[model samples]
Target chain A: MKNNYDILVIGGGPAGALAAKTAADAGNSVCLIEKRPAIGTPVRCAEGIGKELLKEFIKPDPRWIAADIERARIISPNGTAISLEQDKAGNEVGYVLDRKIFDRELVWQAAEAGADVIVKTRATAPIMENGAVRGAKVLSVGTPADIRAEVVIAADGTEAQFARRAGLDTVVPLREMMSCAQYLMTDIDIDAGSTDFYLGNEIAPEGYLWVFPKGDRTANVGIGISGRKSRDGSRAKDYLDRFVAKNFPNGKTIEAIAGGVPVCRPLACTVADGLMVAGDAARVVDPITGGGIGNAMLTGRLAAQVASECIAAGNCSKEALMPYDAGWRASKMGTILERNYKVKEYFVTLDDAKLNTLAESIAQSSLKEFSVLALIKELITRNPKMLLELKALRDTLS
Target chain B: MSTMLRINRDKCGYCGTCVAVCPEDALELIDAYLSLERECIACGICARACPLGALEVVHEE
Candidate 1:
């Protein structure tokens, strides 16, 4: 085994790609590895990003724009609909994207910035020298090889392999994780600019249903139920299909995707000696909704900044990289993600009637004035619904 | 070819995602643990979907 890289990023997802690109842009040699031969194969996400939050790194290229970015529709438990338009003023969200293309585009940026990407390379183990991780022992395309670097970043999504091997505590409690499933259908009757949100346990117990319209009558219809309740004999995809079957009689199913969303906050420690974690790997995902794209990209950029700073000082130790944690927390990404996690637990525990009433109450409110916190407070403000539910939400949350 | 899944049984919440993604029908949920009884090819499909780090395939020595 011989050392050759300044930065080695494992996994070619958003976080890995961004770290490689940013480090390369800073003139550090980077080696980016993906376990799969192709960059982004077998998509596992709903492929949605808040376009407003994407300016942290590079400008939004027209090629990266998946569909019309704009407002969303809120459907109450009783099925009351309330619409919000950007013209009326609300948070701007992007439409469903072709994740395969979006992932490849990020890789292209890394390559242009001077990083070498090797696909089908599985980083099976960390290469530790003197109790400090130097790089990795990779099984590249079925052949064993040692690829070394000064700093190694694991961006392997929610199931972070490198993080676990480096002896970091990588766990997102089952109750906080969302068991999500999706169906891609065509000829769907949904507006391209409006994302449809269905929240109420009766509709999709312990979770919500989403319709991400991508024009051409095609959309990603999905549901995400909390893992705690989902395991108790409920199928999220079944609920999603029932919703689809009831609503879009004329639509045709094209594809299906299933996965879990980490609705937990960033890990207590995301960096160790010569090793760092980013994106979904560190659980830097949203707590309110189980979304990770905006947050993942944000972490990617922040990790890259820290790596660059480390290289300039010729020290990529864990302590040298702690500033990345501080800087990221200072950004809105940390506050919103951690707070949203607490907020999600509250909604996940609500029953059918309570959720429905909460939905209806929220639908009745003005869109611009309706925050996620407002919906929870309206649902269980005066009425102490369940001691366990409240305890589950408020406990263990800082 | 069983998934040869090793679970930190304490961490298993029986989410059943590993069972759903198992192309080989190698896993089943019992007492909040995903039991790997049948042949598991170590495909890793189940491992990726397990959010709690409960399921993994250990190759035979």
Candidate 2:
């Protein structure tokens, strides 16, 4: 790769790939780097994306789309299952992606757009000049090289080391970190067209378990619990193992993947001098659902757009990059993130009985549009005792 | 004299789950290898956060 470019994007996930492609499409020289040797091996995500959201970036290619989810089922602690059809299920009911192929397609598109793509390249440190990030010192395939660029986009996912090294506090709070474990299991009975979510503290404390069908009888069976709730004997894997043992006893686990997702607020400042953070690196994952693929792509594209603008103007200061942060927070994704964070906080506080009561109450009524607000409104109307708490939440939204 | 953290490479998935929960910023996942820095305080948060039970905290005499 070149030692100099207009923009350098760290990480090769959806965020970095989109950033690179967007910037290159804008006629800016861009280079994207991935620490891993391959694009999407050892997939960390559940690979589910909203159909509409996926449409915003790229067409749903069958080569990458594993399952087209037609509905969703929310199972409460009391085994009360609430199902919603595709039209009413909002963004949660969409496509289960094969991320291995999906991520590679994104990078391939980025490369086709005139951006350079390099794998097995780790950004060792930021190349700071007078307290401004000029680029990165990367170890590409064991040979270290200092790459310089006018702007650096940190799309480095959950580890977020590049941002931290560039003087951004990227540490996620222990309580907000979702310790997750997932197993790709086959030979299991599953609704091929429906995604299932199991809620309650007994199963996943302050979190939830999910079963997203890939195809046929194979599915991604996963659980994510609060980091604070994790301990030696009772971790995310422990919970997932117990659930799989009871439910899918005959299932064969072909792949086991574990990672941590930041469910906290995004960084107070996602941009610094000559640097912009995007995707999971910015902690923009949905606090409630732990979904971030769409958000990441959104931020990545926005960051590149803003970076290109600043580069054209010959200014890459933090002030110039501030619009990237403001742009996302003002978008629909931003408003949803703020609302979901609050909703996640409120739901995590509910006990099994409270959840069961709420689930039972909601199960009786049908929501035309299956949004979080719609569900909460249903809860407020059905449960008089939750009126005050739910009203307070609504007030914050307004 | 200090708390020690040991990682069983065989069991470690190198998914960087430990790196994310590390308050001390001690753990770094380099490709397939997971490394520990001197900043590690041995809080065992990473140990607990490890889904594969690949990490352990040991107290030495």
Candidate 3:
């Protein structure tokens, strides 16, 4: 790896890869580093993305697309299933990806765009100059090196150490952190074209369990619960184990993965002098669904674009990078994130009986468009008891 | 006696869930190896957050 570059991106997830590619495409010298030896291994995500959203960055390829989801089913505590077809389902459901191959493909594209890709390189700390992030102190394959750059993009996933070292408070609140566990199982019966979500306090407190098909009879069975709800004997894994035992007793698990997803608000500030943060590092994951792949890519591309503009103008100060933060918050994704956070807060407060009532109400009605707003409207019309609470939520949005 | 945190490397997936929930910023994952920094207070938050039951807090005399 070089000691100096125009831009340095920490982490090799979708965020860093997109940033590197975007910056390099703008004729800027960029280098991307991954702490792991490979581009994507030990996959931490459920690997689901909206079809149109995926097309915004990269075209969907059969090589990376594991399953083409045609329907989404939400199962309540009382086994009430509310299904939405592909056309009616909002932009959240479309494809179940094979992230192992998908992430590598993104990095490959970044390399093809002339960005230097380095693996097994960990950024231990930020190199700060007069309260400004100059670059990072990285350990590349056991050999420590100080890599300097005009701008540093901190796309380093959930750990977010680089941003914190650069004087950003990247700590997630315990209550907002979603402790998650997932298993890739085969020899299980599943709807090959449908994604299933199980919602109930017993199944996953303040969170939900999902069954996402990955072709054949194999699927990704996962659960995410609030960190505050996690305990020694009743942790996320314990909950998942119980569900799997009862539902897929004969299934064989090929791979198991565990991680944390931040369901809190995004960072108050995503940029500092000579530094920018993107993707999960910025905590832009949807609070309700815990989905972030598209958001990460969006922020990554925007950060690079803004960084390139600042570099061209010979100014990389925090003021110059402020546009990156403002740009995302002004976008549709940002508005949706804010709305979803409120929705999640409201739903988590509901008990099983309330959830069952809402599910039954939703099951009876056919939504023309399966969006959060439509669902809320339906709930208001059917359940008069929830009118006040739902109306208050709607007022906050307006 | 003192309270200490222990990590079972065999069970640990090194997925960084502990690192994320660590309010003290005590846990660091270098590649596949998870390490505890000097900031660790042995609060056991990481232990509870660990999905694999890889982390534990114990009292030793």
Chain B TM-scores across candidates: 0.77, 0.93, 0.93
lDDT of 2 by residue, A1-398 (tens): 68999999999999999999999999999999999999988799998888889999999899999999988889999999988786664445589999999999999999999999999999999999999999999999999999999999999999999999888898887888898999999999999999899999999999999999999999999999998898888989899999999999999999999889999999999999999999999999999889999999999999999999999999999999999999999999999999989888888889999889888988867677656677777777788877776776666477
Per-candidate DockQ versus the true complex?
A: 0.08, 0.72, 0.73
What digit string (tens of lDDT, one per residue) describes model 3 on residues A308-368? 9999999999999999999999999999988888888888888999899889988967777
Query: In every candidate, how many clashes are there?
Result: 5, 0, 0
**lDDT (Cα, 0-100) at A154 in candidate 2:** 96
Residue pair clashes in candidate 2: none
Please estimate how well model 1 matches the true structure, expressed as its whole-model Cα lDDT.
0.73
| TM-score for predicted model 1 compared with the true structure | 0.82
Candidate 3 backbone collisions, by pair: none
All-Cα superposition RMSD per candidate: 6.7, 1.4, 1.4
Cα DockQ of the candidate 1 complex: 0.08
Tens digits of lDDT, candidate 1, A1-398 = 33489999998988989989988999988999987768876677877776666666556765655567467787767777766666654555554667788889999999999999998777878999887889999887678998988889889876675777788766556556677787888887878777888878767666778888766588888888766655323556557767888999889888866677767667888888888899888888777766777777778878888988897899988899888878778787777676776776566666667665545554555544334544445444433655455555445344
> Model 1: residues >4 Å from true position, as ranges?
A1-3, A369-398, B1-61
In model 1 chain A, which range of ten residues has the least summed lDDT?
Answer: A374-383
**Higher-lDDT candidate among 1 and 2?**
2
